[model samples]
Target: MMLDRKGNNPLLAIKFFGEGIRWLGNSKLRKFVVIPVLVNLVLYAVAFALGYLYLGDMIDRLIPDWLQWLRWILWPLFFIGFFIGGFFTFTVLANLIASPFYGMLSAATLGIAAGESATVMEVPWLRVVKAELRRAAYLGVRAILLVIISIIPGINVIAPLLWALFGAWGMALEYLAYPLENAGILFSEQRKLIGSVRWGALSFGGLAAAGLAVPIVNIVVAPAAVIGATLYLREIEKK
Candidate 1:
């Protein structure tokens, strides 16, 4: 049965976020989250310091005083380092945050597709990462493409929107690929599983993009967004 797409189309997505958080809480998953978060924070700090130091020197030597006006445009552009810093931080952390959730989504998707309950472990980590490496690579490549496309003059207008959607799509693909890979599905085959339902999956990610925007809330929001994407996939598969 199709879910009614009336009223709070977006609000309904939040319910999935709540459910995901609740599941994580019950699963005592915070311990798993803590290590990854700390690593992310450290990596981000290092990237920031290095970026400023390296980029500052490069900019100083590269840009002449006659082009002082360029600083106005260029300084903000230098901030792209920070954005890249944040992107790598989130890329690693997002996979970590969604690790277990990925397993559940995988098992459920497998069951839905195969008509049998799929077994998924709770303490997912490097194992899940290994299993979904291909998915992660594909997502990373796609994200890079999106970034490249967004840099073009006219395309830059839609950059922000496309970036968000790409991120969300990456998360969904990672979550969906986890269990299927563990079940011995080849990476190419797994991509097809996700690719076949690509449109619905990408839209599911658009809903999670809001959570990706918050500051303090983003820590909590990122994981919840993955959960929501998982739920969204299951819902779509039922159709």
Candidate 2:
């Protein structure tokens, strides 16, 4: 079912998000989620290990001996910090590496949504890898630009709000990229289309950004986003 009639409705975003999760319950889609999850897990493991082995020592040394009791709060605080950092750092990195899988995953989802047999054709593995690498490079460049923007002097103050807005926008774009690209939609066209239902897209993307901040659930964001964005796209198409 489609969400409410209102284009600006954040609640509609939530409903669409729910449909995405339900879409994932299909056994077929579960296979598409595996490699992405593995990539997430491996990166999280390495990050956590480094954080504990090195960063933990630095934090411990920063604390005074007289305030040993502070360990109670400090450890949990460190973990939270790691989690926040990981959510931002790792999700992009993992997704970048797994972009090809996500493209195929998105294609499969689109096929299923249309009630068709699989539309994906057997292509050469090298071609798939090259396309994914290009996508990863594009995203990496965009990420570097965002990082530069975040570090600027005066802009740094409002940089956080900018980051959230950009992150939400990026989340929306990444998922929608699949079907849109397939349909030959350019980035400019996608932006115009999104503007037509601005708030709904933002709400949907903002929530997707939130999902990345959480643990476990963030692992399958690729597939889930495919579902959510597909549903959201259909809504836009109907209008």
Candidate 3:
């Protein structure tokens, strides 16, 4: 996976996802995808339902009867609030619950990339689960800290952009950690390798962030992202 750590192909991140989807026809990889997809779908459904319901209630309460004329403003605000809230909440919760399985999927995909039989690769479920939780907790803490920063007065204006940057970087770190770990690389080394191709990782992660923001399409984003990150790692190794 670190064979070409310096290769900076910015499009590779997104290409991994596209190719991963295409690679699913291979059946073996598709098997790894099923559980994560199901998990995402269920989590996303519940998240969206609850988020919008809460958003609707909040809007109704906030808008005054005289402000009914501001329906246009309130409607868009409702949608924006729901999407933002649901995006982070749904993604965080889904990933947290499915962390171990995602590691398994990533390891299997790494096997496929190495031309090794997926069955031959022994996925340590316990280790993977613990690692995933740690990664998720790390991300969650950073996000919380950023949200806190956004609450500050002078810097509040750029908080959203800052959060987007964090989101993009988090996507890269989160997804890539799977294959890197499978290859026995340390998280510190993974960060350095990724930093060498920082822009490419950003492109990859930014695209992922965008995908996760979409409604129904986001259901497939998790597995697809893992596939893409795996493919991207393999691609770099060949360089």
Cα lDDT of model 1 by residue, 1-239, tens digit: 22223312445444555665664453334544454445445655666678778877877899998986887887688675566446545655556555655555445434433455444445346666665565666667877888788889997899887777777666556544554444555566766666665555555455445444443344554444444445554554435
The superposed Cα distance between candidate 1 and the true structure at residue 2, in angstroms, equals 15
- Can you tell me which runs of candidate 3 are displaced by over 4 Å? 1-6, 52-76
Question: Residue 189 of candidate 2: its Cα lDDT?
Answer: 71
Off by over 4 Å in 2: 1-9, 59-70, 121-161
In candidate 3, what are the lDDT values of residues 1-239, reduced to their tens digit? 44464446676566676876676566887767788788888876776677678867876898888877787876788778767776777787787677667777777777777788884345576776677667677788988889898899998989989888888888888787777777777677888878877888887888888888887888887788887887787778754
Model 1 per-residue lDDT at 130: 68
- Candidate 2 local accuracy as lDDT? 0.71
Backbone clash count, each prediction separately: 0, 0, 2
Candidate that would win on lDDT: 3
Cand. 1 Cα-lDDT:
0.56
Candidate 1 Cα errors over 4 Å, as ranges: 1-14, 21-27, 63-72, 88-127, 140-165, 179-200, 213-221, 226-239
Candidate 3 local lDDT, residue 141: 92
Candidate number achieving the greatest TM-score relative to the actual structure: 3
